[model samples]
Target: MPRTEVPPVLVTGATGRVGRVVVDLLMDAGVPVRAVTHRSEAAATLPADVEVVTGDLTVPESLDAGLRGAGAVFLVWTVPPATAPAVVERLAVSTRRVVFLSSPHRTPHPFFRQPNPMAVLHADIERLIAAAGLETTVIRPGMFASNAMFWWATAIRADGVVRWPYGAAETAPVDERDVAAVAALALCQDEHAGGDYVLTGPESLSQAEQVSIIGDVVGRRIAFEELSPDEFRRETEGSWPRPVVDMLLAAWGATMGRPAFVTSTVLDVLGSAPRSFRQFVADHATVFIDPTPSR
Candidate 1:
């Protein structure tokens, strides 16, 4: 595992929300990037400067082209569980370091005590990465600010009323850009190796408070109505996977009477406070504006 002055870094899930930002930040730091995706045609969408290559992490042999000459890798596991061992093992043999984007499992809080299938997968992959003797940096980001779009965008667009369960459940939502920035730093520098960074925004605010902040930023009064667990389950059953719904309900329920876990890893790593929820809403406010016309 020889280090170079400026080695090419491989970014898996290059086109995804956080991955795209990671790629941009890495490139801005003068690091050559190799963006890996399963679909070769998707390469057209990435920047012309990026070396877009087709590679499937689950299929280790498929990663040959993308892994070649790369000193570090940004791994965003988006595949089935069965192939994780092989993928991580292959990564260990291919690259000098791996920066994995994972959830906040180590946070000592009720909100993270639930049984999440994704967290299970992340743990398994992390063990594999360590067993392989690779320099690994695990970034555990708390609730994402972008979650507002999935949870309340439609209601905000329609009537500006967010009807949901456990509005009192507090969370320190970290912006995806901050997550990406820290990840990019890990990939480009040697100092971040062996670091387990738990990232979150500066403030710990409840769901209702977050919505109110969004309303303030968006220039209106958005109402928050707490829904019953049963109602939330019923509404999301047909749309969201059962396990996912159960996980959210349990996490939110557990955090109802507790404040979310917050950490200053973002500031420690990037030397600045992470983006606030209000800024997130202000930037993407158009998405929450109702598109339909009514009489």
Candidate 2:
């Protein structure tokens, strides 16, 4: 089919870390793009060619406009589960396929097997999508590399010393851009229907090692100070949700002796090696560096 005749892929979470990249990749490939955002102001952040529409996942009726002529939907569920069935039902009626951004809860690794409310939510949503019978692909990306910026950038920028628990716990932090690329491919091609992929970085690195990689990129030797799980909890008590802190502590503690679950899925699907942790840090080195100080 010609580009003009291609039905737009409606992207939920259109301004998010992954969905925004998915929007751009789809547009680059000549597929028409329809982005769904809760706030209409988010349209200014997207490409001018993208058809931005207002939609809220919690209110399934609000999605009708964006789903009206969409061929596929990139579903990013960050809301409560109350309306998933209704939303999936609407997608089944309006779109031919859906690419859901989910987590690797079913992976048998000890790290992934920990009790996670988010995982339960992801599994429930997956079941709903299966029941809906839309051509579906599940993209599960382990630890996003950008999380380094979220978790440690403040400390790194301040003093270059990270105080956190489970410094030796290992994980392969996948790049969001790579995750988005695979999602775009799945959205544009019918062959990816029913495909399930778990994406990870090229190598497994410990939390301390990940910090060191960032330090290396920024030309500084960052100190890694391990905190007891209790100390971490106390430190982040009011700032971070209790459940999230517990979940991370459990996963990291469980995987302390084991290497992270690494995968070749990114290479298998994209025909290129996934970006390494060092490369990811290099690309965003400025985030880890303090701008006010001279290097």
Candidate 3:
């Protein structure tokens, strides 16, 4: 288990919120990268030097070329549960290590302990990885800071106001960039094998406090208005899946008046502090600024 130059690593979901960044980090480290995506168009966005291959995780057979000669694989199981075994088996046959993006189901934190179906899926995948005898590492990232783009960006961009449910509901929003960085290291290094890292921001902040921090970073005096859970539900009913909406409502309601769970795992693994929500906002402030306003 000593460090050595690894063969090309296959990055599934390479065009995803975190996978693209993982690909970038791997390329930066001079680690060979084979970016896996289902669509040929996604290849255009990745670094030209990377070996872009079309592979669907749900269909294990499609991954043969991408997984060939790969020393490790970054696995993100975004599909349904039925095909997971075949995929993991193919991965086990092709690579010695796998770094899986999973949920913090075992963290004992109320924010992450909700009875969510995705958590169940993640658990099943983790079990598969272990059973397949792949040297595995599980990365459990809490609420992603990028969620603001969906949760509040439109309102913030239009009117500097974030109106949503449970204004004081607390949770640490970890940065996806940090998640990718940790994943890149884990994918390339043997030291992180058989590890379970529950990643989170350095500090906890409530929904309202997070909005305020974004406002500060964006140089705007934004306002946070508490909304009824019903309002949020009604607004997102058609867009988000019912189970997801239910999980969110349950999690936020449970965390009302309580601080989110914070962990030192990011710093412990990376030897540096995880990016704060403030820093995340500052870096992506443009996304909060309106481009077109009502005339």
> What would the TM-scores of all predictions be?
0.94, 0.97, 0.96
- Give the 10-residue window scoring lowest on summed lDDT in candidate 2: 1-10
lDDT (Cα atoms) of all candidates against the true structure: 0.88, 0.93, 0.90
Q: For residues 7-121, could you state the per-residue lDDT of candidate 2 as single tens digits?
A: 8899998999999999999988988888999998888999987889999999999999989989999999998899999999999999889999999998999999999999999
- Candidate 3 lDDT score at position 161: 78
What's the residue-level lDDT of 279 in candidate 3? 91
Assess the local accuracy of residue 242 in candidate 2 as a C-alpha lDDT between 0 and 100. 98
Candidate order, lDDT descending: 2, 3, 1
Pairs with backbone N, CA or C atoms under 3 Å apart (clashes), candidate 1: none
Worst 10 residues of 1 by lDDT: 286-295
Stretches off by above 4 angstroms in model 2 are 1-4
- lDDT tens digits, residues 55-156, model 3? 987778999998889999999888889989999889899889999999788877677777899999999999999999999999999999999877899889
Model 3 misplacement above 4 A: 1-5, 293-295
TM-score of 2: 0.97
User: Candidate 3 overall Cα lDDT vs. reference?
Assistant: 0.90
Q: How many collisions between residues are there in candidate 2?
A: 0
User: What is the TM-score ranking, best to worst?
Assistant: 2, 3, 1
The collision pairs in model 3 are none
